[model samples]
Target: MIRGRHQEPAGERESGLADEAEGFLLAHAHRDQARREAEELCAGMPWLTTAQAEELTGHYVRRRLDVTRDLLLTTALRAGQLRQEYEARYAGLRRALLKRHAAGVCAVLVCVGGASALACLLAR
Candidate 1:
């Protein structure tokens, strides 16, 4: 996360807080899982000294965290790219739809005005 001080509106601040909380929870869960896996691996190798097992578990957790971080970063980058692409497509489609609607409205108005003029001429 980029660290900078900027005042946000209440709604946005709340959203940011929620996002932070969610991230914290997810990080904790990942750490817990990694530790559990490390402990299990250490458990299986009963011949290792206490210091060695601790070192191995620490290394394993660090590696797991690094891999997870990299994967999350990649996913976030792809998601951002996808969001931009979809937004651009949506904007283009919206413009086209608006143009078609305006044309249809103009056509309807012209038809109505012509019929009104014809009726007025017939009445005279």
Candidate 2:
């Protein structure tokens, strides 16, 4: 049983290798599928030559990249706008809180002073 247990690691290593091979095969398959789809698309347009098909694919890929770049830029701009709004709100809230705290302190001081004056008069 001890020997069998030691052999388990070897089995696991082989399984790991199999998994890696499967992943490689899957990636290749996906590339082939995309190529096939592109070929079909080119075939549908009988006027396009093989070179033109390749060029079209390149153009599409570039367009996709450009769109993605634009999307990222838009997202960043929106984020910045949101951050500024939040900061403005935070500053306003902070100022309000400070004013409230100051008012509370003044009320406390007045109460203490009034109580002391009453006490002094009563003692006399």
The candidate maximizing lDDT is: 1
What is the C-alpha lDDT profile of model 1 across 1-124, one tens digit per residue?
3478766789999999999999999999999999999999999999999999999999999999999999999999999999999999999999999999999999999999999999999999
The CA lDDT of each predicted structure is 0.97, 0.81
lDDT of 2 by residue, 1-124 (tens): 5765655577898999999999688656655656666667787898998799998766655555566568768999999999999999999999999999999999999999999999999999
lDDT of 1: 0.97
Lowest summed-lDDT stretch of 10 residues in model 1? 1-10
Predicted structure 2: lDDT: 0.81
Candidate 2: residue 119 lDDT (0-100): 98
TM-score of each: 0.87, 0.61
Error of 1 at 124 (Å): 2.4
